[model samples]
Target: MRPSSTLLLVLGLSSTLTACGGEARSQASASPVVETTVAEPQYESIEQFESAAIKRDVPYVPTPQETVDEMLRLAQVSRDDLVYDLGSGDGRIVITAAKKHGARGVGIDIDPTRIEEANENARTAGVTDKVKFVQGDLFNADLGQATAVTLYLLRSVNLRLRPKLLAELRPGTPVVSHDFDMGEWAPDDHKRVGDDDIYLWIVPAKVDGNWQWKDAAGRSIVATIEQEFQTFTGTARADGDRYNLRNGRINGAEVSFELVRAGDETAPVLERYAGKLANGAIQGRITAGNRQAAWLAKHD
Candidate 1:
């Protein structure tokens, strides 16, 4: 028999013959003294084992509870909110949002171990009805139903997710992150908790391209807008005159700017425009001098 088979047989015989006579003991002792060894599990490295078992893009790191509170606070989570937490280790952020703010939440984690732990945590927190833990890739998870989002991922991961966040989330949805910030895409608010950093961003509406609206005098007003994230600069042409856009800013779907006739800095005529962007049109009001009128602009 092979050495392994011999080892198993010997072990079996030894157990059965323990109460046998001296002859049996002698027979067993005379049998081959086969040396056996238990081979230890082999791995290339600790990292390899972790990679195979966890398959996580970022190592599991739990955000501090205080930082979690601050993140929800920064996002202004409320009962009306449905928060989605990506790479949600232990599901603390979403659970806290549910427990304290009365918000419903979803947590996504790539690791099944983490998802299990997060689900158990939610159960212990008595918020299982308000939150759920999903084992899935955060990159492909559906976020369209979320009113608020939270992240505790690396900067590279956040960058990879930036486009998805913008594409899937509705304008005015709040996104809060711990430690890392979306590169180049600045946060609307930031705060420091203990030694950790918390950041908040309000999803901005896409407002690039030409926008056209007529003034009260019924002259044709065509404004060309150039947008980079939430800030934009553009020029408006009405009749045969060109005007410059100043202080152009977009907060969520809300748009505000000042239109000044070019080269009229000495006593520039300023038309302050404020509006909400929806569909392909903006609807709000324009203020000039002491007169205010409905402002409607459509993207062209």
Candidate 2:
């Protein structure tokens, strides 16, 4: 006989429930406190990529493959070229240079992820042996090793990189840019690939040192030369007088300057210097007025 109670329970229960209740105790002990591990979210390297975008980013838009081929063509890239691509998005430029032209190259981009993607792209292109990619700022990237430099940066970035390009790249090294120009330093050549514009520049020789050379009459022309990239300005001292140099410019190995001899200046004499710069000397032909004579200038 059962009495009414506050607790609610069936008096009789299952016969298969382990007669000693051993199964319930075993189950309770088996279920120890479970712990889980959460993998930390992968973050970009602070040394390689900034948490916030810098002014340098020109967005991630890739240059068309056809346009890239055109750039290489216009630059006249050969087997001797060591092409360097600034802001290399997916390494297409350097890969193309290596695969298509058999040139060695390096692609640089500040974003680490972009560099990873670029390296993968290079591998897929089968140019991994010829080209490599790095993560770094494009503005400060080393340009000395490059025989040809490629750019797809904005106009402002182009202007910012112009000095480095002129200073580091060797004379006659071709620099090709897609879309943008280097301010006043005009392009040596231009071409259109489909609807895109490509510009090229041949780095001019450094004529920024003091030179001593003789005129046609052996005038002992000791000239002071100062250069800013391709443009130059300085006085040519001869005949106990200083002559001002006008229209002074350098294009690759080509140099030209108009010299006006002091007060008797009626019209400026055009002096065209065509020579090979080597052995710390500018040795070539100097054409002035109606006379064209052999000229040799030694760095003083």
Candidate 3:
């Protein structure tokens, strides 16, 4: 049967629409569903995290401003002094030293956050020119250039750091600690600020050996010194006569002691010897009553 053109056109259009609809249904039915997933967070061990984090020997504790001022005072911080504040939390100690005492200062801290905070504080205090902040472990810091040091660390930390302080700092350098002290290493001075305790120590010179010098009367004097920290005991021999040292003390490079002639209980002859130690030699004066004379000593 021959169909009309209009009917044929209609038939073709209908077939095309049906085919398109069927293909669209087939595509929709054959489509695969998509599923969503969330990942779980992974955490490392506490020790591993701590190793990656900032290592602090002592916890961060801000020193009171009053205590800071007292610490600087106890250390006798001057404009010529280069003060170092170890374990500086917000750099208050060093900043206070620079601002109040017109001194130069360095602050060492392990935490970067604290280092940043301290730097900002120094800037605000207008002492940036005289102060600097360093992010590092205090134990590993170089303190040779420091004339004074301040600490607000734990007792254990202070004990652990005592050797480094004594080794690096020059003799006569003053060290001040807030609320904690070096075990068995007595403080040269101590003061109370409110409820906080401030302790000071002067680095002692190494003068524990034989020292020889000439007395006022052209007599040769030989001294044997045995020192434990700043206090010492020894005996001096001159002209075949032995004298026992009394009240022997060393403060930095300054050494002083009194000599009393041995075997003389009553009416003992007393001589006071005072000297400054440098280049392994002592240049000082001996005072016997109203008379004073020059004295020189060399470590042997």
TM-scores, all candidates, are 0.81, 0.74, 0.79
Candidate 2's residue-wise lDDT over 1-300, tens digit each? 112211111212323454447766666668787444557656557633452354445656678999899999988898888999999988999999998899999998877777888889988988888998988888778788899999887676789888899889988889998877788888888887766678899999988878888876678888887886678877888879777676677777777676667555575665666667876787778787778889898888
lDDT of 1 by residue, 1-300 (tens): 012222234445766777575666577667698454558667776644544576566777788888899999999999999999998888999999999999999999887777878988999999999999988899889999999999987777889999999999999999998877898889999898777778899999998899899875666799899987788989889888989888889999999999887876654666888999999899999889999989999999
Q: What is the lDDT of residue 120 in candidate 2?
A: 90
Clash pairs, model 3 backbone: none
- Highest lDDT model number: 1
List CA RMSD, all candidates.
15.3, 20.9, 24.6
The 10-residue segment of model 3 with minimum total lDDT is 1-10
Candidate 3 has a TM-score of 0.79
Error (Å) of candidate 3 at residue 70 is: 1.1
**Each model's C-alpha lDDT?**
0.85, 0.78, 0.85
lDDT of 3 by residue, 1-300 (tens): 112223234446868999998887677667677343547645465533543476667767687888888888888898999999998878999899989999999999888778878999998999999999998889889999999999888777889998899889999999998887788888999998876788899999989999898877778999999987788888889989998887889999999988888766563557788999999998999998888999899999
Per-model clash counts, in order, read 0, 0, 0
Regions of candidate 3 where Cα sits further than 4 Å from its true position: 1-52, 263-269
Model 1, runs deviating above 4 Å? 1-51, 263-269
